[model samples]
Target: MSQWQQPGDRRTRGRVLRWNLAGWILFGLLPQAVAVLDASPARRYWLLGLLVLIALCHTVVVNRPDNPLLRHGTYLHLLALVLGSTAYLMDGGAAFYVVSLPQFWLFTRAPRDAITLSGAAAALTVFGGTLHQGWSPQFLTGNVISTVVACVAGAGLGLWVHHFVVRSNERQEQLTAALALTQKELAAAYQQQGAAQERERLAREIHDTLAQGFASIVVLAEAARAAAVNDPVRCAEQLTSIEQTARENLAEARVLVGSAPESGVAAGSLAITLRRTLDRFAQDTGLTVTAELPDVDLDQRTRVALLRCTQESLANVRKHSGASTVGVVLTELAGGVELEITDDGCGFVVEDSRGYGLDGMRRRLAELDGELSVISSLGDGTRVLASLPTHSQDRA
Candidate 1:
């Protein structure tokens, strides 16, 4: 098969064969058909046999258009030339048979070979035609001119068809390559998106389950130690509560890690949840932590954002800040909510990129169209502020 013969080339190959065959019928067969009818019975039968031979040979070659003629297939072109020359000698109408030699050569040979072979075929055709008619000044001159014109016309047509085919093949290859590249890119993007979603899921799970559970354990252990000398019953209860909280945390962690994360926080009880979170933080840290959050209704996402921001801020204070006092304030506005956490710690310079806790807090608030800001300086303090928009309520 030819290199240009792709899986979808069957239709294209068929069209080329049909067009070339049509040209041969009009230019070669029709003329011979007319002349054969005027010849004697023996001559007519001979001419008809030659016509049938040409058609059969051409049919066999055209049937396998994708099979390159150059691959030990010069026989097809030689047969065409021979049959064409014989028909031309019998009658002038079969000139197209000789004319089609260049078209066949174009497919079978390189440019130089095709040109050389086409010239030879033209010479043979002229000689055959002249000899069949007997040498005469008018006939020889006419044969020479007509044969030259046919050869030149056929070569030009064949070259044009070859160029067009080459260009079409190149374009098809380019389109196929581009489509493959696009598919690869889409697969990569899908993989990246899946990875990002997985990471986010893990972060939220750890923050809600393991980290909160650890904080409670620390507080319970501290309380048990303090009550050890004074109240045996209280210490025992504290240990029991610690054990229960630990089991619950383990179960929650298993659920989160083993399956898809829960859909989202519930809308109601946000204020209560926040207050409980703050109470736990105060008990855990033993620092003078103050809060002023109202009982006004807020969406689940907004509540989660504010709660996370508080958790992250207090965590940073415990880990990094040497502060004794912290203040958390939540204010409900006409169209939004504001949260602020202030600390009188040995503050450091705010770097270009905020610390991990602050960055996470910022990202969480940003998802709800909220803004996060931090103000801090050496030896002074740090204040983290967040604000989120809220739709106005309809008063009954």
Candidate 2:
């Protein structure tokens, strides 16, 4: 019932009670009953009455070990009975004292309690025997010596058992505390990992959508400013393109923040979306753009991934490539789809290039179980290939 007492301690005490009960019946109760048959009527009645009292006390101790008052009281009462039985029966009653020794440890909580009570019980047992036998040599040699030896051995064993239980309880408490701390640390690590992953996702989304849109607006504005005086119509068209790009970027921002139902590219067919992007790029940059886009059935996520990859590839081509023409192709492979964007522009060393755009494309494709590969060398045209397996293809 105490905070330090575990269920295991209760079970151990229960087992001790069972063993003690057997000892009482075998050595205490049954012997007293047999002796009652050969005694005077007064002694017989007295032993019978004592046996009933002992049985009742034993039952209360066994049935309600948690009740401290009842358990301790019964233990004290049993010790008194042992003393009385020793005084009345003398040598015959000494066996009851031996059998009752375990109760001192079993009933009390603290080691001192057990030691104090046991020492008192030993002294009372000796006094009761001396009262009847009056320090006779035969009684001193047999009963007195045996009682002292038994008391000493019982006290030593009780101290060892008490210390062992205390150490076991302490160890259990430490392990429980350690396990709780480990669980808290593991949960904190998971929360940190989730936060980091969410940050990375937001960065990728901003780069693919808003950042690319702003870059396009900058390019259009520059072209519009240069053509304003000489060619008003061209300048107006560039300004209009800039406005459209800005509006689209605003929509993308809404989608990112959960205001929009879906991404801007997610509303239409993948082919139509890619063609529109190509047309805008060709009009804005005055670059020769050729495309072979075909409709492919894809989930919203796959479509978004492909569109981002295409946009990133074209943006790279426009900024880095001196080539005047670009080619875009989307085709269905066996069990998969592949998009290839090639430019007849000045290419750089792929390994030496340190850009987040390329890394972002790779990560986006990887999320859809896809892959991106850039093949290019100096003086050679660059080829950006993105491939994703369709669900049907995956099953096949």
TM-scores for all candidates: the values are 0.64, 0.80
- Give the RMSD in angstroms, all C-alphas superposed, for model 1: 6.2
Report the Cα lDDT for residue 316, model 1.
73
102-208: candidate 1 lDDT, tens digit per residue: 35553563445566667766766666666677667776566667777777877787667667767887988899899999999999999999999889856865775
Predicted candidate 2 versus true structure: per-residue lDDT over 1-396, tens digit per residue = 222234375677677678878887888778777866887787778777777776777777687865554544456656655655744653434566677777766666666777677777777777777777778898787766776777788889977776776788788879989999999999999999999998999898898889999999998999999999999999999999999999999999998888987765755479999999999999988899999998888767778888999899888987889879999999998888999999999998999999999999999889878999999999898999999987633220
Worst 10 residues of 1 by lDDT: 1-10
Q: List the residue pairs that clash in candidate 1.
A: none
Global lDDT scores for all candidate models: 0.70, 0.80
In lDDT terms, which candidate is top? 2
